[model samples]
Target: MPTTGRVRHAAPGLGHSGVVTVTGQLGEFLRARRARLRPEDVGLGALPGRRRVTGLRREELAQLAGVSVSYYTRLEQGQSVNASDAVLDALAGALRLDDHERTHLRELASRRPRPLRRPPAERVNAMTLDLVRSMENVPTLVLGRRTDVLAWNPLGHALLASHLDPTAPERPADRPNVARMLFLDPHCRDLYVDWDRKARGVVANLRLIAGRHPEDALLASLVGELSVKSPEFVALWGDHRVKPCEGATYRLRHPLVGELTVTQQALSLPHSPEQSVLVVTAEQGSSSQDTLRLLGRFTVTS
Candidate 1:
């Protein structure tokens, strides 16, 4: 049985060696970036003419992060591969990395590369389809690990992806990944009021997903497309920011139902690691709720 859980993305450019895995690439990437940063960059004054290496010595960084020098060296060499989230956090602080770099570090350290799998002709299960069909009142969507819209309720189609051709969702070749839509789609760009914040979150979540599934060709393609189409996404990707996403308040300016404030929740299934069910709900009695209700009615009628 396929693991029914939200898929996590691996750190970018980590694939190399015999496997081209993110873990190896991440190790090399961190080593290179760390070597480029001078002692001055992290507020340490260089000792004149005595330093052998280009950047902060492994020992020095280990001292700052309060870890053993040998352990840190192993990490740089990709020998000590398994890293806890807390250790990654400590390294981020020791390196004086900004928010984006820190997130990237975590992604590189934590994400697992994907396995080769035959693309299922039908990925979404019948039970999931039934569940979405039953949710006529709330906007619900079933997304594959690659961010493909495998299934959605009618309102979900209208609320989240109105710009996509109706037939696109049903066709694997034509379908749009949610991450791709958020950054590459002009309509999606204009849908959110806080586009920048939303973009960061989207990129961060992508980072998380990429960390976990480095071999997913569909995901890699989506990343490549967004990198080419959206400069903001490109910049963010370069910075290597990453974060796990949960329920969050989002403001959407809908054309038909007017503006609505919604809380988006992602629910993962225990058996499927590559799938998640996301639902957007409005708070009770608020204008946003009224707006959502209106949108729901309009979507159903249409």
Candidate 2:
């Protein structure tokens, strides 16, 4: 299962208010990464005596990263505030973090904690809306930073979420979040042929976004709601993976069209970097393409 991983301990320094600060989240990320490694995995031999800790001990990770044990412990405890680039890079290397995770680590370590505030609702510009609407053949939708469907062509809505109202995106309050639907809505969950892979990808993307916008109140609320409502979401989020939403080929089991494989590509807008237009396409002349055309016809007729 994509979500399979050791559950991480609750982030230290979380107070009665349960607000997670930037430094605290940074520490939590580090601890989660550290817990996934073992002594032999990093070229260190097993020490004598039965090991009590799950993965590498704090001292062991500190030794691997060439930092003092006490200093590393302080960092993990959210007591250290000024970790330099060199230190962060060393930690990333020690943990074997990929490019996305490395970037997330740096973002968490360097960001100043901000007071939680709801951001202005995301809106698709007229030019972008025009572009999306022009894609008559492709299944295309505009997604906000939180994976909210900001706008979608008729075919996009029919293919990805036909059960949802076609005009839901027009109302900010009624806009559907892809992540929420994937975990909580049975219709959305049944659409994916590989639900676990899609779920992990969604969670990983959310993790990266969370690192970048820690003070986003709406994002926090979405995460909190998912955590409480879905245990699978809790498991995936606790794994601390970070991935950018890029192009991927997915096998979808659409309710109306049955099974079809489509390549989903994300295009980021220059004016709105946080919002992306997702375009779904099938290989030319493939049966999936024929299926998509049929779905488009249904969308038009209905």
Candidate 3:
């Protein structure tokens, strides 16, 4: 095959402004992934002369995946919706996607375009609320799929969002979304010592959720708002990264306690998979643990 330049075709359902429809997510993801890989990275020799495109060309990707260039182009252009499992698996393998990215690719490929609908308001069940309250030493909060704080214990509120009213999470409309705060709120941005890493992780997890719930109007709105307000968010979103919400260590510079290192873990609820209890804990016998105890006492007294 000649390494001639090919005319670029916009993916179907992409607007002039480059906004992608729910069904266009698969193509957008594929394009993003393809742009990140080099011919050499995929065991292909560099073509002669200057290349016009980034990463692997369409023909190269198709050849690597053992598929026709036309078929792969159509799949990447959002014209082929009913891709077989084997074909998708082949594409996943060719892209060298990780477990989370592989799952996200499958979700995007299988998703059907649907009218956006406002999902039911997420709530923290009474039992979950009780559980949060019981963990006095551990800073804990219940977060919805969109990273909305459904409920938070006193220590959790003190640890994460002390500037906001302690009871703000009780109201659905006024609830603080951690994603929004990380990008839009200055306080939240200052909270993390490594804001860039934290921000990227949040966006990656949100991308995974967006793939899993394409019909979620509120999630779409949140993404749009962030894209408009935060250039960092726009860049991260365009990277097509997907990650599950999991445990990670963070160094927080709290206005009240100064600084503390804590590991934050998200445990999904069995009855409500979209909701997770986020617990922040410091290692036992560490100075950070002592600081947490001090903060817990301050939260109770104040």
Show model 3 residue runs off by greater than 4 Å.
Answer: 1-20
Q: Any runs in candidate 2 off by more than 4 Å, and if so which?
A: 1-20
Residue-level lDDT tens digits of model 2 in 75-139:
98888988989999999999999999899989888887665556778888999999998998899
Ranking under TM-score, best-scoring first?
Answer: 2, 3, 1
TM per prediction? 0.74, 0.93, 0.93
lDDT of each: 0.72, 0.86, 0.85
The residue-by-residue lDDT of candidate 1 on 140-186, one tens digit each, is 98877767888788889899888677667678778767888887778
lDDT of 1 at 261: 91
TM-score of 1: 0.74
The lDDT-based order of candidates, best leading, equals: 2, 3, 1
User: What does candidate 3's lDDT look like per residue over 1-302, in tens digits?
Assistant: 22212112222222213233655788889999999899999899876778989898888889889999999999988888789999989999999999999999998888776655567778778889889989988999999999999999889999999999988898999999999999999999999999999998998999998888766667777887787788888899888899987999999999988999999999988988899999999998999999999998998798
How far off is residue 272 in model 1, in Å? 2.0
